[model samples]
Target: MTTAEEIIAHLRSLRNQRNIDGMRRFGIAPTGEQLGIAAPVLRAIAREHRRDHELALALWSSGIHEARGLATLVEDPRQVTRGQAERWVRDCDNWAATDALAFLLDRTPFAEEKAHAWSTRKAEFVKRAAFSIMAGMAVHRKELPDSVFLGFLPVIARESTDERNFVRKAVNWALRQIGKRNARLLGAAIAQGVKIQRLDSRAARWIAADALRELRSRR
Candidate 1:
């Protein structure tokens, strides 16, 4: 039987000879833009080791793209640290990797607290990572309070004007998710969406409009 370590080593060996040029042909390359791995292969590798967080961390640090998928496969986010999570978020150069670690795995003990904090970060990817986790958590953890989701409205209201592709998308995603959770929150989200629309920016307008369209309709 291949122990997890042995399996990781084997995977690392394969990475050593990975054809970056060829991978790019298929829209997959070690761009090193965000932890340097393609999305599809990472998902596949994550599926293979869906239960081993320790192994996943080891694999993630290996700097192989597929290992990141495994990191997302980790079921227990508590195993990963805030430091490690932030490091990965900083390393993220693309949406797939940023969301994979932030939304999929790498759960810091202070995830909610950190998400709020990181939302204010200047780095595009890091800020998106924070909000992406907020979106993911809305779906992943149902027990969170209405106050918790309501709190995110201010973040969205402020960030709505960012217009940056990754950041706005994530902020919008978080807003939509909070709205979808229940009727009470839907009303709150709708109000915030209206506030966002009044902001003096195209990005803010779009964010509010799009979020209002969905959140209002559902309620």
Candidate 2:
């Protein structure tokens, strides 16, 4: 068998049904197969096979939760294509996989373009990926100017009424991360959050309230 097949076999061998139950409790139910291995173990495995783009593709095709997470770690961000990112985002079913993929995609060249494009999408996970990319970029892309994130504020406000658990949480995450970036952005983010609170939606209120609390605390 190939190295990818061998690694997948090893992952399956480490499956823990108890851990699977715990993961489900945390809303990480993958639509495909899962071994229920914890993230640290998957990261360790990925470290052993770093920068294996082909292997990452094969593992993603395996449709196992842990393997997909591993793919995010092992794949070369520079080698990732916009088409590939779109395809992977479409396959995401759980927050764990979606967020993991977003983290990887955030490091790619197409991140900013896709983040804006996908944010407007109506699909739950796709939209979640878009904001997840924003959140990841807020933390990771230090060179980006505040204007980029400020531009996203309108998108967050528009989507605040979505009411989907994943989408709302991700929107809040993006707002909070951008706010925490600096003093100036903190004020801007808080102002946006306050505006979001008045939007007449339960999800918007929650996002605004939570972001305000965190942004204020950092002041």
Candidate 3:
């Protein structure tokens, strides 16, 4: 069996000196002095232990910034549990890690329920993850009803007032993705943007204004 320690050691060995500084320059804080390994290297690590859920969990829980990056490379999202997914989001302190794990989870079977449930979470990133999942599904899950996308409008309206950098960004992302899907949704999104602009909060105003501009565009 591939051991978690062995996997971490392998990841450590593959660390690229140049990439760690680049990651920090990009605003991802490093937990230590050494630069983290690249995604291709991490993906190669994940490929070796593809069937070992326990090993994968062990590698993820090790909490190196890049380790979580590797966690996303876990070819089978089903092998991961809700607890694991939720925990990863909670542990996320940066946008890159948060989106990486979210992208992985969004591709899985349980994505819809989890996305809707987490959008209601009080925690910023958890809610952000939920909305991010919705954004991904907007493009990928074509079988879903338009009503499902419509249902998220209320959450976006309520959460648009969230002034936190990450949360509002995800809210904007979800709204933009939904608006771009079709002409009818574009109109609905424009209406919602108007409503959001009228809110008392500055964050809400910006979100509404930004969304309205692009949503009204012909692209």
Top of the candidates by lDDT:
2
lDDT string, candidate 2, 103-162, tens digits: 999988889899899989999999999999999999999999989889888888999899
Per-residue lDDT of candidate 3, residues 1-219 (tens digit): 666687677777777867877887886774533446776776776776665666657756787887767767763677778877878788877777777877788778888788889878888778889888878878777787788778878788988888888889898888988888778777778888899999999999989988888988854
Question: Scored by CA lDDT, what does every candidate get?
Answer: 0.74, 0.92, 0.78
Clashes of 2: 0
Which pairs clash in model 2? none
Q: State the TM-score for model 1.
A: 0.81
Off by over 4 Å in 2: none
- Highest TM-score against the true fold, candidate: 2
Question: In terms of lDDT, which candidate is stronger, 1 or 2?
Answer: 2
lDDT, candidate 2, equals 0.92
Tens digit of per-residue lDDT, candidate 1, span 1-219: 345567566555555334555545554444542233445655666565666766766666766566555666754676666677777777676676677777753245577887888889999888998889889888887767788888888988878889788899899999999889988988888888988889899998888888888887886
- Tell me the spans in candidate 1 whose CA falls farther than 4 Å from its real position: 1-30, 33-48, 105-108
Error of model 3, residue 40, in angstroms: 4.7
**Whose lDDT is higher: candidate 1's or candidate 3's?**
3
